[model samples]
Structures are given as C-alpha cells and as structure tokens.
Target: MTGVPKILMTLGAIIFVVGFLMQFIHIGRLPGDIIVKKGNTTVYFPIVTSILVSIILSAIFYFLGKFR
Candidate 1:
C-alpha cells in the first residue's frame, strides 16, 4: 500500500498493541501523575502519562520519517 493507508494501518496496529497491554498494565496511574483529594472532592491528572505518550509518538514518527 501507499501513503495514508499504510500509515493508518501502522497506527491501528500500534493502538491495538497498546490497548491489549493496558489490560495488564495500568498506564494512567503512573507515580509521576498527579492526584488530589480534599473533603468530598477528588481530582486526577495524568501528566506523566501524557508526557510519556508524547515521547513515544515522537519516536515513532521520527522512525517513520526516516523510512520515508
């Protein structure tokens, strides 16, 4: 295949693998993520998870570009 279809297939595979692994690995609850609780209110933020995802995506795109 060429261009968009190929890229879409690769991304779909990557997402599938990540989703499968998430069944056994709790990704959003990483230590560096933030959580706050007060009285009857609680808040959660996946800062570390977002950063990790950004880095992973950057690496994947970089390699994909190299191959192009």
Candidate 2:
C-alpha cells in the first residue's frame, strides 16, 4: 500500500513535469508526422512523435527496472 502511493506520487510528478515542459517543447509536430489538409478540413497523425515517445518511455522504464 505504501509503495503504491509512492509510485503514484512519483508518476504524477513526472507527468506534471512533462506537461510543464511541453509548453516550451513542441512534441506533436515532428518531421515524419503525417498532416493532410483538404480544403477546410485538416487531418493530423503524430506517428513519428508517438514512436519517439515510446522509445523514450521504454528507455526510462528499462533504466528504472535496472536500478530497482
């Protein structure tokens, strides 16, 4: 129980920091991301951004598990 709370708090803090940093870091508009504009409708897909985020998260989890 105690561990769960600590984990949640840590996760929340990480999320808050990421959100705060995102204000200055444009994350969704990577070069490889798809964007389509047809007349007035625009469709956007952050494929590259998703992959980047996944890689970063995987590395973070790998390091955390390694340390644990």
Candidate 3:
C-alpha cells in the first residue's frame, strides 16, 4: 500500500519532465512520423517517437524488475 503512492509520484515526476522537454525538443517532428498538411488543415502523428519511447520504457522496466 505504501509503495503505491511512491510509484505514482515517480511516474508523475517522469511525466512532468517529459512534458517539459517536449516544449523545447521537437519530439513529434522526428523522421518517420506522419504529418499531413492541407490548405487549411493539418494532422500529425509521432509514430517513430512513440516506438522509441516504448522501447526505452520497456527496457527501463525490465531492468528495474530484474534488480528487484
């Protein structure tokens, strides 16, 4: 029970840091991401960034679990 709050706080801090970095880093503009721009409309998707983030987070969790 006590560990739940600590985990939530850690996750929140990680999310806050990522949000802060996204403002300065064009993470959504990485190559392989989809960007459609029409005369008056624009759509964007960060596929590559999402994959990279997934892999990184998976590795982090895997290692942490191993250590535990």
The pairs that clash in candidate 2 are: none
Selected candidate, larger TM-score, 2 vs 3: 2
The segments of candidate 2 whose C-alpha lies over 4 angstroms from its true place after superposition are none
lDDT of 2: 0.96
Name the runs in model 1 displaced over 4 angstroms: 1-9
Write down the TM-score for model 3: 0.79
lDDT (tens digit, per residue) of candidate 3 on 2-64: 899999999999999989987998766789999999999999998999998899899999999
In what order do the candidates fall by TM-score, top score first? Answer: 2, 3, 1
Whole-model lDDT per candidate: 0.91, 0.96, 0.91
Q: Estimate TM-scores for all models.
A: 0.71, 0.91, 0.79
Of the candidates numbered 1 and 3, which has the greater TM-score value?
3
Candidate 1, which ten residues in sequence have the lowest lDDT sum? 1-10
Q: Write the per-residue lDDT of candidate 1 for residues 1-68, one digit (tens) a residue.
A: 46899879988998999899989988787989999999999999999999998998899889989998
* Native-to-model Cα distance after best TM-score fit, residue 4 in candidate 3, in Å: 1.7
Clash number for every model?
Answer: 0, 0, 0
